[model samples]
Target: MASCILMQFPGTSDPTVTVIATGGTIASTADAQGARVPTLDGAALIAHSGTPIPTRVIDSTSLDSSSMRLADIDELAGHIQEAFADPTTSGVVVTHGTDSMAETALALDVMLDDERPVVLTGAQLPADDPHADGPENLAGAIALAALPAQQPGVQIHFGGMTLPARGALKRHTYEMQAFTSSATTPLSRPRPVGVHRLAGKNVVVIAAWPGAGRAEVDAIVATRPDGIVVAGLGAGNISADMGRALGECLQAGIPVVVSTQVPFGPVAFDYGGAGGGNTLGSLGALSAGYLSPGQARMALTVALASGTDPAVLLA
Candidate 1:
C-alpha cells in the first residue's frame, strides 16, 4: 500500500472521506481540440457537489490501465490501507479507469484488512463533456461510502449501481452502463436512505495457488502453450488441446492452475462432463475452486516469486 495524508478542518461538521485520485477519464478534461487529457484534483472535482464530506487527494499521476502494473496496484492498495487505519476517515473512494478496473478492484479486495467500504468510480468520457458520466459516478461512490451500511471491501459504483469488485467487468467499450454484475442485482444498491439491503453473498477470491499455469501443468502434457485456464467454457472445462498442454507442463515440472473463467462458479473435476477437466485433474493441474483468475494469478505469482512450491497454493 502507498502512503497517504489526511487534510481536514477541526470542529467541521463534515465527515472526512479520503479520495485517492489515481487519474482516469473521470479526472480528465477536454483539450482545446476536445480530446481527453488528465486534469482536476479531488478538491476541484468535489468542490461543486455541495456535500459536506471532506475529500483528500493523495495521488495525482495518471496512467492508462494498460500501463498500470502490479506494482502500481500494490501502491494504490498501500494508500487505501493507510486511510482505513484512520478512525476519523469514514471511508475511501478510488477514481480509476474502466479498462482493467475490475483487476485493481479485485486486487484491493484481497489486500484490504478492514471492512470500510472502498468505493471505486470512473467515467466513460472526460469531465469536460456536457454529458460526462464522471460527476454522477463520483457522487454515487462518495454517497455509498458515507452510508453506515456494511458496504465494505472493494466495490465499484458506476452508472448508478454498486457492484462487488470481483463480480464487475467492463462489458462495453463506450456505454455509460458498461460494467455489470454477474447474473445478480449487485452486492449493494443505492436508496433514498443510503446504500442498503446488500445481497449478502460472499464472493470468493482465490489466488497464489501452486502450479497454476506453469510447473504442475507441464508434467501432465507436452507442449509450449499460449494460455491456460482452470476450467472449460463457463465451469470446469478446458479443451483437450489445453489439457495436452497441461500434461506437458506437468511432465516438465512446470505447474498449471485450473481456474474457471466464469465470474461465478467453481473449478471441479469429473462431474459427468465431456470437457477435459477430469483429464486435466488426473494429470495434476491444480484446481482453484471458486477463486477468480486474478486472485489465483496473484497467489501463484507470490509463491513463484518466493521460490516456494506452487502446490502450496492448492491448500
Candidate 2:
C-alpha cells in the first residue's frame, strides 16, 4: 500500500497540493557500495524541500526512472486521478527521475484532463550530495502546483523553467539545467485518453541513420510490434529503402509515427521522395510534429491502448 501524508502549515488555506513521489535522484541516497539508489519516500522529500505549503504527499513508487515501464506510468496516473478526485486537492507535484521525466509527463498529459496543474520535477544530483538540487526543484514544483492560476495540463519544472510536457527533452547528461523545449506552448493539444493498461501494446522506436534501410525496418517488423516510431533525419526524412519498408508495414496495418532526431523543429512534410516526410505521410505514417521520439511512443502507446486512431489523435 502507498503511504499518504497530509501536511498543514501555519497561515495556509484549504485545498492542498498533492506531491506524488515516484522516486528519482530527488529521493536517492548513496548506498554502502557508493552507488546511488532511491531510498526516500514522498514525506521525506517534502521535509527536505522545506516548503511550507498546505500539502499532501503520496509515496507512489520507489524507482529509478530508467526502470519505469508503461504499466508503472499507468499506475502513477491512477494516483494522480485519485488526487484530482478530491475537492481539497489544488494541484499535483510529481517527483520523478530525470532520465524519463519528459516521457512520463507526456503520458500524463495524454491520459488525464483537468484544470489543475501537474508539475513534474527531479534532481540531477542525489539527495545525499551536499549540493543536491532536489530540494530547490521540489520547492519550485510545489510552488507552481499550489498556484491557483497556474496553467493546466502537464508541465516540467526544472532548473527554474516551466516547460510544456509535449516537447520537453533532457539535453544534458549532468547539468543543473537539463531540459529544453522548442515551443513556448504545446504544438498539439490531444484529447485525454482513458487508458486501463499498455500490457501488450508493443510500441518500438527505431532511429534512422545516414544508411539505414529495409534491413532495419524489416528487423523491427519481424517482432510484430503494435506500433513503430521512426526517429528520422531532419524534417523526418529517412532512406528510400527504409521508407519503402515502412510503407509495407503501413500496408499491413501497423501504425508508424515519424519524428526527428534533431533537437528542435517539427517534423514537416517538405520533401516528397521515398524517405521524405511527404512520402511517410502518403504511406499513412503519422507525423509526430513537435514531439520527441520518446514522447511519440507514449502518445502512440496510449492511442493504441485506448483504441484511438493514432493519426486522428496525434494530429
Candidate 3:
C-alpha cells in the first residue's frame, strides 16, 4: 500500500506545480450501494484540473478516507517533502476524499515545515456525477498553490471557501460545501514538530455517554494502546467513572487526551469533579484544546511516535 506513481500531464515550461493524488471522491466512481467510492487515482484527478501547468503527479494511495491509516499519511508527507524541495515548484495540491480530509490535512499541517502551499481538496459528488465539484476545487487549489504571495501552511480549499487545516472540519455530509471554520477567530492546532511514522503506535478514540461505566476505558487500557483520545461530554467533561479509568491509563504510562465532541471550543479546567476538566488535568490527562476528537487522535498518534511528551505537545 506504500506505492507512489509519477504521472505525466500536459506541462508548461513556465512555473511548475505538483498535483498529488490520493484516493478520494474526486477519484471515485459509483458502487452498487450507490455511494461514491474511491476508485480513481491521481492521474484521473490531474486530467480533470485542465492542465494547470507543468505539473508533477504522485499517487500516494487510493484508499477511501475511512480506509486511510497512519502509514499512508506518512508516505504522503514524504512525497510532499521531496516535491517541495525543488525550488521551481510553486506549490502542491492534494486530491482526497472528504470523509476524512480534516484528519489528513491536520496531519500534514503539523508534520511539514515548508514554505509552499499544500492544498487538499475533495468533492462531495463523485467523478461520475454530472455536478461534481472536484475539478473546480482542484483548479482553485492549483491557483492558490501557484500564488506567488500566498502564505505557506497546510490548508483545505473547497466550494469557494478556504481555511487553515488546523481548524477545518467536515461539518456536513451531503452538502457540496462540507468543510467550515470558526466565524470569529481563525485558530490553529498545536504546532506539529515533524512527521512521525505511526507504524507501532497504538491509539483509540472513546466517546463518553450518559451514565456510561468505566468499563469502556478499562477495556481500552487493558489493550495498552500508546494513546487515547476521549471525546468527552459538554465542553470536555466526562463521567466520573470514566474519569477514574482515564487516571488509571495515565498511571499505567499511557497518554490520555481529553477533547470536545462538539465542533468548537477548547477543553478547559474551569470546572471540577471526577470527570471535570480540572480533574482530568490533575490526573495527567492533557487537553486537545480546540481540536475535535478526530483531530486530537491524529495529533496524539503522531506526537507519541515522535516521542514528544503529550503534555508538552498538547500544551
Candidate topping TM-score = 2
lDDT of 3 by residue, 68-114 (tens): 88887888888888887777778898888888899888778877877
Alpha-carbon RMSD to native, per candidate: 8.6, 2.0, 2.2
Worst 10 residues of 3 by lDDT: 4-13
| Candidate 3 TM-score, true structure as reference | 0.92
Please provide, for model 1 over 184-266, each residue's C-alpha lDDT reduced to its tens digit, 9 standing for 90 to 100: 54433211111111122122222223224433444323343322444345556655544555566566655667776676646
- The lDDT ranking, best first, is 2, 3, 1
lDDT of 2 by residue, 1-315 (tens): 677888764444477999999999999999999998999999889999999888998988999999989878877898998998888788999999999999999888887888889999999999999999999999999999888635557999999988888788998989999999956555666778764587567999999988776997888889999999999999899988898899999999999999999988888988988888898898789998888899999989988888887765566
Which pairs clash in the backbone of model 3? 27-40
All candidates' lDDT scores?
0.62, 0.88, 0.80
Candidate with the larger lDDT of 1 and 2: 2
Estimate the lDDT of model 2.
0.88
CA displacement after TM-score superposition, residue 290 of candidate 1 (Å): 6.4
Q: What's the candidate order when arranged by decreasing TM-score? A: 2, 3, 1
- Superposition error at 126 for model 3 (Å): 0.4
